[model samples]
Target: ILHVTLTERRKEYEKAKERDAELRNLRDTAKLQEFFLQEIQLGELWLARGEHKKSIEHLTNAIAVCTDPNKLIEVLEDTLPPHVFEMLVHSIPYTLQV
Candidate 1:
């Protein structure tokens, strides 16, 4: 009976470990997307500095990942820096039309 209990506990531990690994992968994916958002935010800085070409490129890519541009703009607005929000907001109307 003791041996059986130990085997069950080991199985539970292995399952927990597997869950942790999956969670880690999910966390990494979130981090990568956050990095992309940061890039978009940085593009706002470029626009402020009159680097329109690079700014549009980065913003375009960011909007592409956004399945719902309107919803995404709303959700991301408060989280982003003010100028970044400005740029995203400015671009959103055009994206909706497209």
Candidate 2:
């Protein structure tokens, strides 16, 4: 009986922790959205001005913070010049948020 009670308590504790984390993420959503937008805009601006290296840096940062990097990459691929998109792919870190 004691073992079963302890197991149940542990599960409840884990669920509570997950809920708290979700709440914290929700609170930070606005800040994250702003940052993501800034990075993407800066990247696009630099790319338009023919600054390949700077554009790659900003785009890589955007990808790193993105929750859905695959979708973002698809959009970028469709929008960016092929060579520039290739550069971004190479520069993007393996440790993406997604």
Candidate 3:
């Protein structure tokens, strides 16, 4: 019975470890996504002010950090006004040259 209890406990410990690892990965991904969104916003602000260079810098940073381009586009589409989103999309070509 003692051996069986130990085995059960070990199994539980392994499962807990896996859960913890998954949680950590999730937290890290969330942080990255937040940072990406912030960069995009900063880029948009720069673009609005006619600071194209600064806008490109931030947009490039956002693109670099994007793990899922589709999700990034979806978030931008949902969060930004149409004109602002269009400006952002337009800036991408210029960003690639920088």
Candidate 4:
């Protein structure tokens, strides 16, 4: 009975560890999403205000953190003007974080 109890406790501890890790991942993902949205929104705001350089900077930051930049780029292509989109493409870092 003691051995069974120990085994059960060990299994429970392992399950708790896995749950903790998963929660941490979820929190990190949420934070990343918040940052990405903030950058994208700021970029759009600057772009609408005709601040090309500032817009590019924020948009570049957004792309840097984005997990799937190609998809984001496609969406941006549709959202931004051709010239602006071209500029953004050039501004992207060679080594993206994601």
lDDT of the candidates, in the order given: 0.72, 0.89, 0.79, 0.91
User: Which TM-score value belongs to model 1?
Assistant: 0.51
- Among all windows of 10 consecutive residues in model 1, the one with the lowest summed lDDT is 64-73
How would you order the candidates by lDDT, starting with the best?
Answer: 4, 2, 3, 1
Pitting candidate 1 against candidate 3, the one with the higher lDDT is 3
Model 2 regions more than 4 Å off: 1-25, 94-98
For model 2, name the residue pairs that clash.
none
Q: What is the TM-score of candidate 2?
A: 0.68
After TM-score superposition, the amount by which residue 52's alpha carbon in candidate 2 deviates from its true location, in angstroms, is: 1.0
The per-residue C-alpha lDDT of model 4 at residue 1 equals: 100
For residues 1-98, what per-residue lDDT tens digits would candidate 1 score against the true structure?
A: 99999999999999999999999999987986896688678667777787766676567566766656556566666665676567666775675566
* TM-score, model 4 to reference: 0.83
Best by TM-score: 4
Give the alpha carbon lDDT tens digit for every residue of 1-98 in model 3. 99999999999999999999999999999999899889989978987897866776787679767877667667777866676667668776666566
- TM-score for each predicted model, relative to the true structure: 0.51, 0.68, 0.66, 0.83
Candidate 2 residue-wise lDDT at 31: 84
Error of 1 at 43 (Å): 1.7
Q: Which stretches of candidate 4 lie over 4 Å from their true place?
A: 94-98
